[model samples]
Target: MDSIQMFLANCNLSVSQAMRKIDSNSHGILFLVDDNNLLVGCVTDGDIRRYLLSGGGMSDVVARASNQKPKVARSLAEAIKLYHNRDYVVIPIINNQGIVIDMYMGEGVKDKKYSPLHLPVVINAGGKGTRLDPFTRVLPKPLIPVGDLPIIELIMQEYQSYSCDEFHIIVNYKRELMKAYFADNEANYNITWYDEEKPLGTGGGLSLLRGKLKSTFFFANCDALLTANYESMLKFHKDNGNVITMICAYKNINIPYGVVEMGENGVITDMKEKPLISFLTNTGIYIVEPEVIDDIGDEEAIGFPDIIEREKQKGKKVAVFPVSENDWMDMGQLPELEKMRKKLFGE
Candidate 1:
């Protein structure tokens, strides 16, 4: 399919198909058209999310989640003007017949630059990755290759795009190999090495950098990759007076069988077949203040979630920043790693 066709979805297409099109397209938008190739509506990732939140299922038609009245240019001149206005990255030009004839994609739209964040990133890469089995027996989880780059490098590069260059990595299992891999590589990432003599649970590793990180930093697990907007997340974190902002993903799970709702006396109140359920799941990424490190004791093996709960119990501001399920990829296990590789490299 051509580049433009990838962004075009039929109005009768399933929500799942529209979602795939949106994910594969350069722009986060899908243009919905009718059987006669007439413009019907526009669907974005946000629209699908809101639809899911409103109990819309994946089998529903794309039209139900799309904007019936969308901003479109009637002529080439108008499309150019709209594109130049910086209000949109791409403008669809429809003829009088209501058919999309062409599109005006602004220059650098696909390669848009983001402002630098200039924040330190703390990555917990010390896990033995027992779930990966024999592979973990040879290599650490962070050293596992997602594509050409290892998972740790990929994580660092993602943050580097937002100009977050400094990285503080905590390593324990296969620590020497992790350190040696970075030492031999030519990628000039600003890295500070922290060693754990023994395994420390996720949050416990942060204790090694008690005096290192004096400012706010990005904390992430080496096994997960999140494509959410870091700048927006940071803004929300600071605006809400949060001590730690956990990034969570809204996961939608579809049940295959009919679920009968039972009330008092075993009376069936309602029945819905293959209902789609949405839940907010932790993505293992967080924006943390330096002060939180004080709560973690040295050589302690506490998980990160435990720390968050403790802070909440103490009445500290702990917030959650939500992202779509598609934005977060957990690569801790074999199946998930393969899925993440295909998603990242389109294999």
Candidate 2:
């Protein structure tokens, strides 16, 4: 595809299609145009996410999630000036008729760097990845390759970009292999190892660091990688006075075929064809306070979700931060692993 086509999408395109375009373009934006090739709006990953969070469906048209009035340049000189002045990664040059004639990409747009977060990150890497099957039989899921680096390393790097340097990894299944891989790597990462003697569910492993984390820290699953804004999530957690802030993704599942709703006496009351259902699902990432560690009992086989529920029961502040479906990468299953690899490395 040509450069211009890569970032252009018809207004009638589905939200999912527009998401794919934004992901592949690497500019994190898409120009929505009408049938006449006139610019109608601008769509970004954040725009789609907000649409989904607000009950928008994946099959909804791109126009429903796009900015009706986007910042634009009228000419090449104006585009260049706007690009540097606003530090924009990409800007569309439009004519008097609002038709996009060209685009300007800022220098080093592809190599943008994020500010450091300097927060501690805790990764739960102790689970036996039964879903991945044969692959997990040899190497632990965390060590499984996602592009050039292991899944665990990629998860760590996501945090490192936010300047989160200190890592606390909880390991159990094939623990040595996980440690050896990190030890052999040239990239120096500061990590603290916590060994789980037996199979402990997600929240159980956290009990080991009851006193280690004096301040707020990030907790993530080894099989998941999220590209959402960590700073914003942290701010939300603190601002809300939440003890645990879970990160969730607004996922839309489109069910195929028509469904009939039966009433009394098997009477068909309603029928809808290929309806789309939206849900806010846990993305296995969190910003947690240190005191919550006391709520978990050592060696207890309880998942993190259950822990959150218990905290809620006690009236402790617990909240959820939602991200777009495209921001989350689930590497738990073989199919998802391949999908994540392709998404991250264009494999």
Candidate 3:
């Protein structure tokens, strides 16, 4: 931020105002101060999201969504220790008088993006990439360039950050080219390649590895990348006893016109100007148990969502792990490829 003021907000600000400030600060958080400039509480974009999801409106006062007991430091030295010990992005340094003095951004966790999760990952790269059209005619979707590296490589490197080095890639269209590119590359990826003789839709390829994966593994689509904390996701899946945990992203979309809701006979019960709709969209990423792979029926065409539904119907513990909207990136389309390029490489 240009100044520390961007991270500081008056405790009386509205939720929408705090949301905008947090967006501008790019830290997803803000420290709120009272009239006397005393630290009152802290609010984060996540707090606002939970509020909205729980039927709270954006026009509500931010204090209603604030965490009353926020973690703060008395000195920079203490802030640095707290910053590393806890994964806090920003910590406010306050005086004994309970007045806001300074803010500290520490150093340690900045260099290390992720800890070791040590899980195996399965990448579904079998699609024909028809959406990409002419480009798909030559190079496969997995080999499509996002920045300097292919999208699949970027996806793999993301998993590698958590020490999940083992990869199982299911390839169909242009399988030979996909294999050839990795065969000569020196990234030294421990990859097991699976071939689908007939085009099996998203989840069908798992049938090929029915007996292979013995433990928990990540299942991902090559066209999208997820930046959520892998360790936390794994813990949630295990603690919840979920056989499949589909990673979802909170997507916020704004309506251009006034949204109206009618109760009966042209009687408008509720109306809002330019309403923002929130949805938990699937990010095409999953943490799956061995049972899920074994449950794959046949060499039939089936999307992953259908598989999840089938498991849900069978009373299997299927769950969802949600991340912020910015954490997921999809490069399935030509237009989104540019967005992905800028997000990954700042081009």
Candidate 4:
């Protein structure tokens, strides 16, 4: 249980202060306290937005833009239940004196029991590595060494950090090699094999295990290394009623030449020189509901994105969360793989 001092606002705080408090606390809420260290009211992003949208001034007192009585819970289960009920980012816990004693965050809860976090993950390890060429000719891309460890082993370790143990590796090209390597290593993760006799596209192999999984799980391409809080991602997926949640990364594309935005009559609305363009690109990581397995076609080449888009057309909620740029490492090409080796091994 952690809390902020109520009477510490000797100086005026900005909206950015509130945002920082919310983020640091992981609850998406901040409390406005009085001189006696008593809770005056609580401020949320929505509350601030409402005041701003209603033409309220930024210099107004925080108490004027807060909720009088915020929803709260005493125990962990009740807190989780409240988190599932409302879209609140944080819940404040106050004692009889109306002073905030604790704060419960919605994004940092780990499953105490094995049930929620132990979903069956699918690893798409079937891609033909033409990019790495000669090196991949002898080794499957999944088994390619990132440092002293295989690429897929590092990926599994990342998921294991978040308590995910059950894994399903989809194998096609050099399936026996992957199995033999895993058999040689005395690893402890529970991995089930899904062997494709013929070459199936990345998403097509997942259909082979359609009936094998029964809980919300994750899927990833074996080549990309991403570091993210999987528990927070899963909670976001379930709390928002989303059937599928794709993890995206902010990628910047540099323009060598000057860029300009022109209007209909060729008038330059805005002009800039070699500005960097940023966009969210898929990191090939996803959390998907179990029922989506029923949507997998019986064809040999159906892809996961195509099936997800079809579900979206049928009104299923699909969400996306962004990750940091430095956190995503793709070992698909020789140059990138070399960079990863240097970063991992400090060579």
Best by lDDT: 2
Candidate 1 lDDT, tens digit per residue, 15-64? Answer: 77677677667477999999999998999877876686578877789899
The whole-model C-alpha lDDT of candidate 3 against the native structure comes to: 0.86
- For TM-score, candidate 3 versus 4, the one ahead is 3
lDDT of 4 by residue, 270-320 (tens): 987976565567888888887777777664676667767978998999977
lDDT of each: 0.87, 0.88, 0.86, 0.73
Model 2, 181-205: lDDT tens digits are 8898898789899999998898899
Rank by lDDT (best first) = 2, 1, 3, 4
What is the model-wide C-alpha lDDT for candidate 2? 0.88
Question: Evaluated with TM-score, which candidate comes out highest?
Answer: 3
lDDT of 3 by residue, 39-104 (tens): 889988667766765777667899999998999999989988998898898988889998868878
Lowest lDDT 10-mer window, candidate 2? 106-115
Off by over 4 Å in 3: 9-28, 33-38, 43-66, 74-88, 94-101, 107-109
Q: Show model 2 residue runs off by greater than 4 Å.
A: 1-26, 31-40, 48-67, 266-269
lDDT of 1 at 149: 93
